[model samples]
Target: MARTTTPLTNTQVKQSKPTDKRQKLSDGGGLQLWISPNGSKSWMLDYIHPITKKRLSMSFGIYPAVSLADARKKRAEAKELIANGIDPKEHREDQSRLQELTNSHTLQTVASDWFEIKKSKVAETTSKSLWRNFDKHLFPKLGHRPIDKFNPKRSSALKLSFDIGI
Candidate 1:
């Protein structure tokens, strides 16, 4: 027969004390509170990787900062990701990378890159005048926007803004 784990309460969690070695207090469903000998407490979730069938541990966050309730919610979210055959850690890293790419590809950054090549090909005065127009008109309204968010409707709206002196 499989042994059952009793779910932990907030009081039990709060009253836990660190020992000479690391300790894990289970809250059932693979959620555990890890207490280090140094008195640090953090939440951890144990799960089997969908593809590998190997057990893995993922850190939720620190105690107090991530309450028992919050840790349980994260555990549910991680289990959902695992059920869909996606590793939560990899998903998180991919999201971080995508956000970094999106942030780096803002309108002003792309425009500056194009302007560098244009400067080398055009006469100095023409290049300066072109950049001046971009700086004065487009940058103020759309410079910080991500390139991926642009659409035909928004593009035309921007053109209309220039036409109407907005």
Candidate 2:
């Protein structure tokens, strides 16, 4: 197979040293390793926004942590997204937001966190009553649900429970 000129070799990447000014080493297909003045290196892709037709960059990860091969793979994936008319930067942001949403504390998680905090500040009897109230009233209906989805105005269950004094 004929050797490509653009993709950088491991030796070339390993030999790269940072200078006073930052340097960018192209590994072909828009994958590049940016060497900072402090010798820290990170992988990024330089691409054009699919919709806006503007130049943009997105970081993959740090060098060593994100090797040249890994960077190339990331670049290929970005290229695929671009070909599909999706900007990689925006796609990345959307993925990040989705991850954040999924990982955010649910009602149960927030209640537990609040309980821990309050336990440290309040009397033991008050803490026990709070826990009893949560276990009886909140956890059965809303604990598993994310806090964002809980609308007080729309919850008939809450109104019923309040009327019954449970």
Top TM-score: which candidate number?
1
Which portions of model 1 show Cα errors greater than 4 Å?
A: 129-145, 149-166
Q: After best superposition, candidate 2 residue 5: deviation in angstroms?
A: 4.1
**Model 2: CA > 4 A from native:** 1-5, 105-166
Looking at model 1, which ten-residue stretch has the lowest summed lDDT? 157-166
Q: Give Cα distance to truth, residue 98, candidate 1, Å.
A: 1.6
Task: Estimate every model's Cα lDDT from 0 to 1.
Answer: 0.88, 0.84
Model 1 clash pairs? none
lDDT of candidate 2 over 68-161, digit per residue (tens): 8888888899999999999888888999898788657677887788679879887899789878988998889887887777676788755665
Score every model by TM-score. Answer: 0.76, 0.64
State residue 101's C-alpha deviation in candidate 1, in Å: 1.7
Candidate 2 local lDDT, residue 44: 83
- The lDDT leader among the candidates is 1
Q: Cα deviation of 90 in candidate 2 (Å)?
A: 0.8
RMSD of each: 3.6, 8.7
